[model samples]
Target: MQLIADSGSTKTDWRLIDSKGKISQVKTVGFNPYHQSSEDITERLQKELLPQITAEIETIHFYGAGCFTDLACQTVKDALKNIFPKSKAEVHNDLLAAARALCGHQPGIACIIGTGANSCLYDGNKIMDNIPPLGYIMGDEGSATWLGKQLLNSYFKRWMPKELRPKFEKRFSPSVGDALENVYRQPQANRYLAQFSRFAFHYLKHPWVAKLVYDGFNAFFDKNIVQYTDYQQQPIHFTGGVAFYYANLLRQVANDRGVRVQNILESPIAGLTLFHQGE
Candidate 1:
């Protein structure tokens, strides 16, 4: 059996595939070397994952957020090796997983818009270039966190419609002060911010909300996608909750920018399964 994982900051999707192509799946809390220690990851694996496996694993392909550096990748690899000592393990950054999953053996541009956002240019087999994501603080233009930031800014400044303010306040029950405290001096601020994107989705019919979504996507195209050579000719693909849920809005933004969207997957686990199975 082989194990494949597609992970982001919010959650992980795990697939167990047997030699005959039979597959089973499970979910666990997300792991990031920058945020969680090796011990923390091992404990979660023991508690949430190990018991679910019914077969001996042969290899483990772990693609995750924050595994961008060798030290970070080694940290996760060591933890996995400690548990499944007999299996060979490979740890890689989530971007490669998105590229493999979205582009496969075809060269194209792959983008991710989940709690955060990122984009890369893939040459059929490997990433040719990448624009720094810079996380939610400095960048992450079209991500849920970005949208949430915009929504909060509008709400706090009372820039949204007067009628919408009461509804927003009632739904979240957070004043501008409370929201500021969470964002400026709180843990998991990105996740906290991303939670509000649901509000944006719910009120998408509102002109203000529509404009916010469009402008955020436009920023992503201008800053990230447009920088690549022949980007307009490449098939643009996406994999993440934000892109999957708001596909129409994303496509609209792409259309306005004179680009085309080829695919949008809610998660990459299925494609990752196929990729690993072929390997």
Candidate 2:
């Protein structure tokens, strides 16, 4: 049996696929090496997550946040190896997996616009280049985190009209202190910021929310994507929660860049299936 996991800041989607192509999917708490403690991660896996398919896994591929460095990947690999003694485990950064899911063996630009954002150029079976996803601080434009920040700022500064701001505040309170504290004091600041993004998701067409989405997407294109001048005209593909949830804004941004965008997959599972089946 083969196991594939796609992880982001908010959650991980686990899939177990047998040689006959039978598949099962489960949802687990997110595992970001940058945010989660080793013990917390271990507990989550051993207790709540791995038990779902530990009995069936023979080989595993984990694509997740904070597995970018060799050290980080090794840590996760070692942990999984301990859990599934009979299984071979491989860990990789989530961005590479997005590229794999979107580009497969073809040359194209792959981007993930979700809680965070990243982009890369895949050159027919390999990632030829990547635009640095500098996280939320220095970058991650066109992402949930960025949009959430905008929403909070707007509400706090009274830029939003009282009619909506009151409702927004009642739901999330738009407090900078609470927002800053939650992100800094917890293990998953990215996740915290992402939670705030749900407002835009529910109200993307709202004038205020639409502006945030547009600005955020435009910033993402401006920072990491526009640098790929060589593949500017190539077909671009996207995958992730935000891309799936907000297809219109994503498409608009792609059009603005003069690039043809194709296939906005909601989940990586379909692409993962296609990849394994050689489709």
Q: Which ten residues in a row have the lowest lDDT in candidate 2?
A: 270-279
lDDT of 2 by residue, 163-260 (tens): 67877877886667887797778665777777778888777667878878887877877787778866666778888778888888878877887877
lDDT of 1: 0.90
Q: Residue 151 of model 1: what lDDT?
A: 81
lDDT over C-alpha atoms for residue 173 of model 2: 61
The candidate that wins on lDDT is: 1
lDDT of 1 at 150: 84
Go through the candidates in order and give the C-alpha RMSD of each one to the true structure: 1.2, 2.6
Enumerate residue pairs that collide in model 2.
none
Clashing pairs in 1: none
TM-score for each model? 0.96, 0.87
lDDT per model vs. reference: 0.90, 0.78
In candidate 2, stretches whose alpha carbon ends up further than 4 angstroms from where it belongs are 35-43, 54-56, 183-187
